[model samples]
Target chain A: MTTVIRELGDEQRELVLNMGPHHPSTHGVLRFVLHTDGEVMRKAVPEIGYLHRGLEKIAESTTYPGYVPYTDRVNYLEAMFANEAFSKAIESLSDIEVPERAQYLRAIAGELNRIASHNITIGCITMDLGAITPFVHLLRERETINDLIEALCGQRVTHHYVRIGGVAYDADDNWLKQVEKFLNHFEAIIEELDNLIVYNEILVKRMADVAVITADDAVGFGLVGPNLRASGVDWDLRRDMPYGIYPKLDFDVPIGAGEKGTVGDCFDRFVVRVRELKQSCRIIRQCINNIPDGDIIGNVSRKIKPPKGEVYSCVEGARGELGVYVVSDGTEKPYRVKWRSGSFSAMSIIEHISEGLMIADLVAVIATLDVIAPETDR
Target chain B: MTSEALIDYVKGLLGDKTKWADPEAGDNFLTVASEDWKNICQTLATDKKCSLTYLRNFTGTDYPEDDEIELTAHTFSYSEKHGLIIKTRISREAAVCDTLSKIWPAAIWYEREIFDLLGVSFNNHPDLRRILMPEDWVGHPLRKDYKQQETYRGIPTTRPA
Candidate 1:
């Protein structure tokens, strides 16, 4: 149906505003075709792909080892998760063995990456809800984790730390010590954030019961990560489809059963990510304790050619399921390489969730969905 | 679940529409006719035994050299049944498939994406706009023989080969 925007007066015509593919508050280069009558939105249809780098097409040309750097650029917030997803998918496709030490190291970095990503999720959600303090506070903690990534791979945000088979560098003594110190402070900050955002009444007024989606719609729409779990569909790739050392880790997959108001709203989505932060910490602590010493890199085939078959390996990305489908013709180059991006599902929620709300609320909804534009565009 | 039973079960449900045993259980193919797209998806999804609720992704690959366009639907049942990925191809002429967006609303953008990058049109998509590329863009870039000389807005690009 063509959305009909009627004018309030002859002088005051309905305005169709171009939000942006360059607005920083848009989170990334996400443009919105927002149909509004001044402040209230009639319809807000998101226009994506302003930052489309076409990584999947690029992967078909690059070697298996050459694809690692590309994943770093896919999801800039959760760089390690994208890296791990690519590396793990290649490892699974080739049936290469990653050592226990490497696996443990991968788990630590992955969970830390999850924490950093969650911090952004919670921080940005709160900021979008008009609480600026939480955004800065959360970023202050996210930078330390970025420092750890920098120590490993020399770059912070776009970390090329994970290779095809295993992590590029092992967590040395100092790195472990730094991680332990951060974990202590991280716990306290999370507590403060809970008090500030989760329990706050003003945040609840803006978030709770806004843009509610049912469990049926959640599954039907294939919402993943905290979004799916927030809607009460217990489909986590880590536990259900075990990859790496996640199955061994002791933690609960947190769900949002409408603590404040109802499931599948902005607050519940934020709560799910907040709860996941604690669970991610639990997994990281277990990883730190049981981490054995061994080689970091695994035995990836030199030529890195798989059988003339298709293999898709999906890991539990910080946002959702991140998979890479490789169609190799028993050659160094792949016939096709498709990156199953997390944000694709996250952004798809816009179709169902953006129907009836103010334009500002639409931004709030997108921020709560926590989609990375590069990941979606790629 | 045993591969044999999983294979047999899928065969019974899909009948002639799916080729279960022909492609091994390790992320391989089963051809699907364009007519059978929605039924096959609904069967794979709604059947309580095979609650293939989680859609991993839907992507298409264009093989201009082979004159075949491939579309793959990677799905898994969350209620502890099985995971099956349907791989199908269409001869370059009738490269259209009925979209499963009605069955799985998540397929909206995904089908649009396949439509966007690979030019595999999804018949009856609600809003089949170019998702990742500008609306005015000419040819799909992911096709094997496709070119990316000028962008959607007619801005010419020069990059070292």
Candidate 2:
């Protein structure tokens, strides 16, 4: 009466494994079809659009003011930057004027947002690179910035602090002082981070020359932000194409050291963001003192449409160059609204860049790209 | 360095071939044939003044009633300090265009999106797969001809097309 049970064969051979769209690590709703040859990745085809809500198409249907909330969720990582770009779009379209004070305040918050975003990227990079402790350490510091954002905008992550013409409100003196103090303390902490990871022999060996993307290929891939610059594209929307009070602000736009990939590698990307944190601190300090006094948001054109014309508004977002292309037909709602997202370019290159890499290295590559999946899908 | 000045100079480069470069207010745009978008993009990208390396976006708006698909390519020139929004329309029957991915690598995803939602095919895109839609999804959602009472996922949407 004994039954013989046979073990199923094909235990350790080549097989296709699906990771996400919801598996804790793909971040948010990202599906990666991983073809692995025993832990070594044969192919990593990231199937996105699982979360595409047709945001651009939706924008054309909604009124100008109504689309602000939608913009807040476009990237989700850099909501403040998204809000800024969206507001800039409306402002440019209708010629809604923003005053000097509002511009300075926008810069201040924009700089703070830059720091927050960089911290996330840094923490996430180390976290992916087998250093989980640094991720928590980075987030611990980032929480303070989040608290400040919450106090300023009444929400933590998706702080809809920006409006059409300018910011929704202004920061008090106490908040500005706190921001300044945070900036100074952040520099010392970042140095400690450098000591921890930047010069560490293990981290460098793991990261250096891992995923190399040439500058030419980077351009072909339409990469932007730190990812693009890391590959030797001397282009930054903030510095090269100035908007808000960024033109007046004095800070060095940090170029990638290029010690990693050809021009765009993971290590240089880390270097760029780390350097940007310091630059953002400098920009914020200057903004704190130079901030003027006036109305925050102006009267945006609410009821009617702009004209039977089109406008493209671009701004240097935390991730990359975020643009909103609007086609109006002299109505309440836009005839067409397309978001030229920076992440769009970066994400598109995954096919070209992610081919034939290891699983652990693939995750590292994903972090270096610094693309929020929602932004890519949306 | 202004858009108008840049357009004026570009017109000079074309030497009377530059037709339909309409300058409306601050925006100066040109409408070329869908087939010519890639070559034009290459010229814009490589030309000394119009170093429009950044393919700002590639999107299309559908008008089923008009039986046309208006495709737009927004390019920016860092050297000239101006942006040029190029627009062209193709017959609804043939919603096809040359892929600008070669001239501008950024256009790959954009072309995929245009292919995914708008149902516009890029002739030679390296990986012209669906971007914001699933691999086995039914129809392009952004197409004016396509009617969607609700999305494929049936995610309770109150907004109408």
Candidate 3:
């Protein structure tokens, strides 16, 4: 923690600085109003909603199946998780049964998306900390994941692949072979990222002991995913509340051990994401090896109207627990839809923790949180 | 604890304050009066039997037919491994309720968002302002009767037919 400096008279007047809405490091259209006394920040107020698209309002008008494409736009980086969460909500409401092979396919797509998202998180964090080489290297590896996803689904970024009953399409033998080939070399790529950036002394010194969040504060502020795990709270929605084929697969949830500094600092958050990349790879390998042979889509009605009921379903997204709450009116269109995004809660805690930190370190904290603006403001 | 036991425990605590409890719903839905919203939330967050510390999601639903706006909050307890959906209905004319930002800081943003899009107000909120829309926006867009403006500062606001 940085010490607050106080001086008398006109020389010590507090300065107000606006940090984004167009700044490159913000990753999107996010603005922070900082009230600083010299180098130490007195208060940092986050002004979000610049990228708000009224996705919830849009969901009310679109039918259950028609809204699947819009779900991809909610979180562009990890669209599969968003797609799965929305689809699962519909499935629970209508009591639709998904095929076993489709569950495995969805898990494989989700893990691949998780790896791609983590690559961006690590790359952006390192690049923000003044290391440019690792970011390019990580993105180069991400290209391979993108290629694999493109082979399965037509689109690369927003793959609206998860349908209500199952996935949009089945992966052919060629697609499965390409996934196996990518997994064979993925472990070494994670190790290369570890050596190139994670172990670098400058990166550790810059991130360690910065923006520490205790376990109590993490829960009180509703922090989820890596941010909450980094605070040393052993909670992951995928492990605790098993969904789809995640219960069948075996993997470990990494928690912050405070190796570089105290628990829940920037370093632990960065390291947790790095470790998760390996876990995602392990899940992917298991899913690909044991994928069953059956029909991809289940027997669902063409009308796509759910009974008059409300359901809330969540999946462990790239950022955290992405939940979808849908209220149906026994009609073609939904009555109400609310998206509980992980980034929204992650961004809410920044105002409390940003006080008493240097302005430059604020960027590091934001990067480590890995909040996508569209998800937060959606 | 199971969701049924959790709801029973909350029912015992709230007594008359608990308007309705449906454990069979997707997420155990519990409705309470708007007056007891703050205290009930405080008890839910702090009580050992039902310590729902995690505020997962919060939003408002508009029901013009009922002439009320329903504010719903989804809370989960990591220690207990249970969840409950708490809701309160207030008349649209006076859509004000007590703020839970003190109990869970995450509610501040949700309350602001509801206030922004649905026109719900939270009393004693530290910063109760529009979140998703600009401060000077004309109407709450999520309401059933909300109409789009033709223009904003001389620029066409609607899509061309």
Which candidate has the top score in DockQ?
3
Q: Which stretches of candidate 1 lie over 4 Å from their true place?
A: A1-15, A37-39, B1-4, B21-26, B150-154
Please give, for residues B1-161, the per-residue lDDT of candidate 2 as tens digits: 77668878777876544556443433557887766667777887898888877677778888888898998888875445677777778877788888888888777778888888888887878888877866767878777556655555676546655
Summed over model 3, clashes come to 0
Which run of 10 residues does model 1 chain A get worst, by summed lDDT? A1-10
lDDT of 1 by residue, B17-43 (tens): 775424332365566776676788788
- DockQ leaderboard ranking: 3, 1, 2
Clashing pairs in 2: A21-A30, A220-B105, A230-A263, A230-A264, A231-A263, A231-A264
lDDT of each: 0.79, 0.77, 0.90
Q: Give model 1 RMSD, 1 decimal.
A: 2.8
lDDT of 2 by residue, A121-230 (tens): 88888877778888888888888888888878887788788888888878899999888788788889889998888767777776788778887777666677777778
TM-scores of the models, in the order given: 0.93, 0.91, 0.97
Q: Candidate 3's residue-wise lDDT over A83-166, tens digit each?
A: 999999989888899999999999999999999999999999999989888889889888999999998988899999999999
